[model samples]
Target: MRLSTTQGLGDEPPETNAASSVRKKPDGAKKVNIGEWIDGRYIIEERIGAGGFGTVWKAVESKREEFVAVKEVRHKWLNSPKMLNYFKNEFKVLERLSHESTVCPIDLVRGNGTYLIIMEYLCGGSLSQRLRHSEPLEISTALLITVRMLDVLKACSRLKIIHRDIKPSNILFADKSFEQPKLGDFGLACFKSELLALSPRAIGSEIAGTLTYMSPEQLNGKKLSVKTDIYSLGMTLYKMLTGRLFFDPELLSRAGIKRAILRPFREHPGRYRPDLPYWLDELVMNMISVEPRKRPGDPQAVLDVIERNS
Candidate 1:
């Protein structure tokens, strides 16, 4: 159930408030009992969300009756000695991030063989669901979402963290109580200096994110910077506005995907939504430009441009 912002903030409804107090089964991993309490604090509740790497659960702190989100990294995947180290390293990176719009880790727990991260429990579902099922949101609503997300990216940039993946699915919307959107899932996030200084071995090469939202430089396996994320955000905004992707229909084939990446934005915009404002269209075009350098210098600059147009 999604909470509406119109209900006003700070009042937890009786139903959800009651359920929030009850512990239930956690979502995702099958081999273990996810509802089991970790470190005798967070009591695993029902599964709330999932992603490629792990599942997120609504959990309650038994001692304080406080609610939180628990992200569990699958034990099987983490058992690999190398992967375990990488998982631990990622946690360290997350610890360095502190932002209201970005989901922050509250606690870390290491179980028999798995690792769990405790985070703030957001009542609303993901932005991806809102975009996919709901009617096309008003341009103002879309801009509000974009501005909040940019706030998150700006905070991450201050700490030199580059969120390689920045799509609708990774952004969670809080119910009216929290009111603001929160950016989640930092598993693929990398430090700017570390990414720049990496040797081939250190990079541990692989295509790491969703292909539909990938930046051209990312597709080519080049080292990424903040601009790569800007490109993705631009694509996301385009999809949100038009309710369609910016790719060619023929691009699903092996040869076509490469060709579509090189396709110009002008050839595609008219096909989706011709009525989009010229300035907004131009901003998106600049964002998904084939050259990363051609994209906005930073997420803040993108937000500034949108706000100026607003």
Candidate 2:
């Protein structure tokens, strides 16, 4: 689909986050400007978000007259064959899971010294933006978002895929109305088998996810289960209800984060929004319980509660 470059911080795919997370250096890739044509089909509209690995640009599909987001690999990574393969592999994972809540892949192009992935352009700005400007979202709004997200999580679970990163920034709305909650950015997702084989000693040595929403088990690198996602979703729910993070960003060190996770989590959604009913308050708490066993692993169970509350 061809699309124009709409205003606002467009939905950022996982590659954008990956690019910025890597060492800050010039991303050595060919750059294209506005009005430039790509593959003689899509025309570059504007640079919406930056990714060192694959910079995302808004483009218009000339044939279809629709909007699409294109991600182009940077120059420095061309020699590394693995990067290209990695991009293709992750896209395949996303490309397979088709659903209304998931981002749609339009095209994957192999240009000279670069790779480009075209995705559905999301214009409604992310849930993060909602919290940034106005948080503690309406009770009904939060519940609606949670219910829809539960479906997306269930879809991923059925395929044995674990989206390691499930944060507000990754939850996007299709339009400014914020009625549709679409999940994007699967850069850190993994198949269930990938973690099941990891030995205990290797678990904590390398974990990939946002620390703020990471569950204690994930932070400690224990055998990941569906509960890993439960904790992150609960954390997302908390932010939506209270407009705050479970832990302060200052707790970035390994020891500091571990201690925070192990400590008793005293906060609850009801604490901030006194108007919240007891069931929802309890639901959020149970989902984010420090112990993996305490968190409900069933997405439908959580969805039921959210629907009831909504």
Candidate 3:
């Protein structure tokens, strides 16, 4: 199940698999309700969200009454000693990044063969949810979202980090009251400098991100750089403003995606939102160019163009 950040705390639907559900408590013992406590400090209030890699829970600090989001990655997956080390190392990388537009990771904890990542809890839903239920945002609102997202990309660039996966689902709203956007889901994030130095022969065949949002280079299993993320953000902007999938999911096989990217913008310009400005259409087309070099050089440049148009 997808985990969404919303304003205010509320209980979610109960899990039906009571037999398989296991809770880890403060004393490092396993219990039926695993959400009770972990490492003797965190009191798991409830399960907030779950994904393929792990589950995120809303937990309270038993002594401080502080609320935090805890992500639990199963020990079995991290048992590969090398994998565990890499996971811990990422926490250090996250700590170096500080930006208003990025959802920060607070700390990392380990207990009873489980690794838990503590993070600040935001109260707004994801950009994906916003786009799904609401009408297309005004140009000004869309620009605001884009600009904030750019800010996030800029910060990551400064740290030599690349968010391999960039999409609407990963861009989170801060809170219902704020209406500001923050970048989330750093699980696939990597330091460009580090990744580049590693031998490609060691990498596995497993694709690292959502299919629809992947850049052509990503789909081809080619080496990626910051430009890869720019292409994604460009596609995200197009989808958010147009209220339609930029490319047909049914036709999203690698070759089809490449061809779609190579096509002229004029062909699909009016398919989603007929009245959209021609300049905006051109901007998105350039952003999603199949050739990474053809896309915007950086997020700042994209934001500058968007702000001026808005």
Candidate 4:
């Protein structure tokens, strides 16, 4: 039997990257409908998410009698031979990585025009939802989640793969208990070139991250290193621990927002919630430093700090 999360909080569908689905087109998002069977094995159940990059549906793989998430890319992207190849390359990269704290890829399929990526389904909803509805999480709880995500980043770093996007929304709970936080939208940045070449709307929300979490180096178009993800990770932990956003991009114009991210670091987690620990303030603020060299050298370095502080 398949295990499921008991979300006592109501059975809200856990979300992946709906915005990572597809580009807009005259034909619309996708051609599938509820109750339809595709690939001759997986049966579509319902529309779960839709974004600038792609669309996602809840489905059941008849062969395994198990639930799965089907991600779709529209034909508009396929029409571009360049994008089509990039999609294929990205799939290959995602297919190779096997990490427990990351959403696992199942299969990739090519439809009449759309392409579909099948992945394991989770039920506990996303960290973004938790942040949106609940008060600040306990410091211990926030640390636990951060440590697990650091574990994921350590594994990714081994392969020199940078998770360009690290935000509350891309973090998934394996169950309603909310303990197992697996990174979602993995390997979506294998096509960072595509993202840099396209606008946020065209590349989708999940591949990169919102302007608020971006590192100063990323904005400046400097070559990225592990520190890029660390900057966003710091931002995510700040939100979790304080139940607040670090910077409100909406309040600033495009250039203003860029300048804010580029500004020297002057605040820490404790600034918002005085009860936060000194160790936490030191670790997080270091990660959020404007210069990549000022951040932790790697996920392992940050993990070591957590161990020492804890």
Top candidate (TM-score)? 4
What's the residue-level lDDT of 168 in candidate 1? 81
lDDT of 3 by residue, 188-285 (tens): 67888666523222332221566577777776667888888888887788778877656676757856755665554424444677788887888887
lDDT of 1 by residue, 137-159 (tens): 56777677778877877877898
Quote the lDDT for 176 in model 3. 80
RMSD list, candidates in order = 10.2, 6.0, 7.2, 7.1
Model 3, residue 14: C-alpha shift (Å): 18
lDDT of 2 by residue, 195-261 (tens): 5533323322322566677777766667787778888888898889888766666646866776776
Q: How many residue pairs clash in each candidate at the backbone level? A: 0, 9, 4, 8
Position 12, candidate 2: lDDT: 24
Candidate 3, run of 10 with poorest lDDT: 1-10
Range of the 10 consecutive residues with the lowest summed lDDT in candidate 4: 1-10
Q: Output the better candidate (1/4) by lDDT.
A: 4
What lDDT is reached at residue 117 by model 3?
76
Candidates sorted by TM-score, best first = 4, 2, 1, 3
Model 2: clashing residue pairs?
Answer: 2-61, 2-66, 2-67, 3-60, 3-66, 3-67, 28-75, 28-76, 29-75
When summed lDDT is taken over every stretch of 10 residues in candidate 1, the lowest stretch is 1-10
- Give a tens-digit lDDT track for model 4, residues 1-310: 1212211111212223233343443232246677877677788888878643456789898878999987765445545554555555545656655788888887777644456777888888889888886478998889899999999888777777777778898898878876899887653454333334243445443344567787776666667777889999998998898877566666889778777788884567798899988989889889898888889999999999999989
